[model samples]
Target: MPAEDDFTVTPYAVEGDVDYDRLLEQFGADALTDDQRAAFPDPVHPLVRREVFYAGRDVDAFLDAANAGETHSVVTGRGPSGPMHVGHVFPFYFAKYLQDRTGALVYVPVSDDEKYLLKDESVGAISDHARENLLDILAVGFDPERTRIVVDTADADVVYPLAVTFAKDVTQATVNATYGDPVNVGLSFYPAVQAAHLLLPQLVEGRHPTLVPVAVDQDPHVRVCRDVAAKRRYDVDKPGALLSKFLPSLDGPGKMSSSADAPGILLSDDREAVFEKVRTRAYSGGRSSVEAHRRRGGNPDVDVSYLLLYYFFEESDERVERLAREYREGSLLSGELKEIAAETVADFLEAHQERRASLGPLEAELPKFRLAEAERRNARRRAGFPDDSLAQQ
Candidate 1:
């Protein structure tokens, strides 16, 4: 294990204290320049404007296409190893914001197979989680015409063959070097499936700019896929990446995950539950006593409650800045700050839950968001498979 202060970030786990700048340097991705931030369509998403999504690879190409009203797409995905939480929905919501603004086509691939390979869970359990996760994703209200939700196992007819085409070019050595040695053969071959996911939109729609907005920990997957695209065998552009900081867990200073033991506010969490969790579990950066806190202001920088608000919940730049100012100046009590964050997050969740409740059955709703037969065929053909290769055995 790495030492307490020595951070380790990988697709499978993130540990220790991450230095975002150092991580960017190690990844060889460029920091988001001011010009790049200003180039996003009017009313930029908070994630980009606030520099939470602070680094990227090939961002300018995607932005240029979006600015010129050309076709572009955003690929972000989920691994249904467990229940959906507040942290899981940030990128989906961010994608929706971009789609609404720029009409970016969104591709959401649920990597159930990868989850099963990585976890010790039964296939049935992983499938169950995938079903529940798909519901939460649909609740985000991506335009069905503009979005495609792919389940790896369910869509294996298309996904597997596509993976096979790319898998030929991806060596085991590369996989081990990019990600640590895999425990299973399925895991070893997953980077190819991921490449298929990133390049699928372009494969179907023809070569065009694609942006993948993911947490920085997932950058390696994009890099691997980019290498495949760079091989120039396929008529696809190297997908751009919009890398983000990890959404802090309630206990503070780490990735908020469904797998964590900490009390994460789930998408299904009610207002009361949200309040209780934030009140009791959220890490505080304030002084020990109320008197001490009043005498010496709290540090919102490390406070989970403040982070929740600043990260996504609080939209207004002026308001979030004021909250930080008050916290630093000792006017805002820790409890008061927690309450504010809890209320804001609860309100957002309630709206999400309401939308989720209003949706019909997943079976009825998922078809429109899935790749059509023609699309599947076109993508397969682009991958160098024969036109008749898609025929069943």
Candidate 2:
């Protein structure tokens, strides 16, 4: 899932409480409720607020400034492990919306590294498909020039020497403290590289994206970035982070990944396939029969499929509220609700596929200086600059 990760980047956001009720009020029925908000403890709280979606140390302060029209930038990422899935749409769509509404410079990283570890395949074989894959991502309809998606592995080869130099500066205790296991060295190295990517726009001399928006599981990684940035030994940009939860999969609680490693509800899945999957495989919390449902109501908490629609559809307000009302009143039938939820989810996936097929390449090309600057910024690190490591915020 694009939004869910334990530690793919660095500079962890100091965790804090989020005002979920206000989020639901701000986002209306579209946001998570107070009940769900309480499910996550302290630092996890504010990360999923309605307006901000997710929060961390830099979240509140940056947002305060952003509302005043400050020129801060935000970064979000995508893992190039496989074809983007239905669940992947939420963050991209969300990112597109945030950029359009706020007019902030957005930096998007196509995280090929995570895929290197998560999947059996290498990205090199898919080189030709990179443009095609990104075109599909663009098809989802965010402003073409407002965002940047770097093919991380390609950049990594050029950036790794600096990454290694930075890694050497972090001690085993710091690494072990943040990540409990000492065996996962590769995962540890990824955070630093991601931290470097966070500062890439800044390294070029003019652009500095100060905020990063990602899913909640990824908070650990950003916390590392924040921790390291405080020390200021390197030229790394310490970005504030806003997080969102994994868009629950059709089958379960996390991001929807294809079970057999084939295509999922692609930003390209066809109508027939969409309906078939939604009706047959999507998670359902409704009971077996109408009478049983009337007596017990539908179970929304464990209902994965409905939640899928809840997170994706724009028209969800009335239907979901009504469904919830019926369930609570013991007058709703689970089967019927599931059918509606299936339709809602299927329609969303179908629409995404259409939009994706019609999209174009980036309109405003990235400034050449941006890439060169990132190169030089990394080059400086390779020239024996002291590395500062992440600590808990």
Candidate 3:
């Protein structure tokens, strides 16, 4: 969103990794761990959240810290894998609440480098797609001035010198403990890159600050940041953390992989395609028979279609409840739910598409990224600092 007018930006009409329906079949009604649940809110003790995220443990102490702040950074990011999808929407939607209520700063990191590995899109195309995703993020109404957009794949000067040097600061085990196996030596420095990203802005010698909005699944990066911050390695940066839940697919609980053969609401998907996917593929935990469903109330927690509505359709609590009741009574069918998702999703995409297209990449990139400043400041940070924050593609 911060780079809405950038000419370098483009629309990402990307696809999801799996379908909703199959993910539901593969993993059924389940709940999150205590740590994951805690991550639903901002954490206290700056580095504490990351510790919990990396350890896969929960810390009530961290949550208590988040509650004390009047404002905090709301961080969310993307790999620019392609056009956005429902999987991407819900997080930003939730982030809006914090952004509005507290008037907090939000940083949207476009991790197209990570996406390149995950999706195999050509580097040039993925780089372009990453910019498009930023505009879409802006249209969601995030405050541009208060938001910072970092494109890891962008061609820049000072950043390259600092980032590579920073990589050496983080060790292989530390990154591996959280990120798991790296694809190669180049990949091993990911944690350092992540660590620097979390705190780099403070090193800018300006008043601007940072807050991170990482998925609960990506908590490890925060942990690494906290560790580096404590080490006083970066010296100037002090970052806050906000966490969000990843919306499950219509399939059910657990990760709805982009690889599975189920319905996924892709950002690029059109009205008809979305409708068809919803009608036939979106998983609904409704009864096979109307009478049986009516006899027992439906599980809102498990109903994939309703969850989509809860997270994305933007309906009121009462309205959502009414819809749930109808679904339980068998008065509402899967087709009906699918139809709603299709219409709502398409409407959002179509409306945003035009506004985004008008916001060229350079318009967005030139102003928002502060390339000259970031590079200048980065040079200073790396001048005296050790080579501990580098990560290669």
RMSD of 1: 1.5
TM-score of each: 0.98, 0.73, 0.71
Give the number of the best model, judged by lDDT. Answer: 1
Candidate 2 ranges beyond 4 A from true positions: 1-55, 125-132, 156-158, 161-165, 180-186, 205-209, 234-237, 261-264, 360-393
Question: lDDT by residue for model 1 over 13-121, one digit each (tens)?
Answer: 8988889988987889999999999999889878889999999999999999998999999999999988899889999999999899999999999999999999999
Clashes of 2: 18
What's the CA error at residue 189 for candidate 1, in Å?
0.4
Q: Which 10-residue window in model 3 sums to the lowest lDDT?
A: 5-14
Report the lDDT tens digits of candidate 3 across residue range 1-393.
Answer: 122322211012212332332322222212224554544444222222222122222223323333555334555677676667767765675566556644655656666666676565788898778766776776666666666667775633444555665665677887665566676665576666665455545544332335555444455676666666665555544454444344665455544445445446766677887777667766678777667766764566566667766655644557777887887777777667667666777787777666556665657444663434544555445435433433221
Residue range 1-393, candidate 2, lDDT tens digits: 113323232222212223333423322223434643443322332224332354344554445445566665667777665566766656666566556656666666776665565456666744434555665666666564555556666665435654565565566666666655543567667777766656554543343447666665566666666666656665644677656655656665555565573225666666677667666666667777767777777777567656655565534366766767776666766556566765776677666667755554444332321344344544444434323322101
lDDT of 1 at 61: 97
**Best-matching candidate per TM-score:** 1
Against the unseen true structure, what C-alpha lDDT does each candidate score? 0.92, 0.56, 0.55
Ranking by lDDT: 1, 2, 3
* Model 1 lDDT on a 0 to 1 scale: 0.92
Worst 10 residues of 2 by lDDT: 9-18
TM-score of 2: 0.73
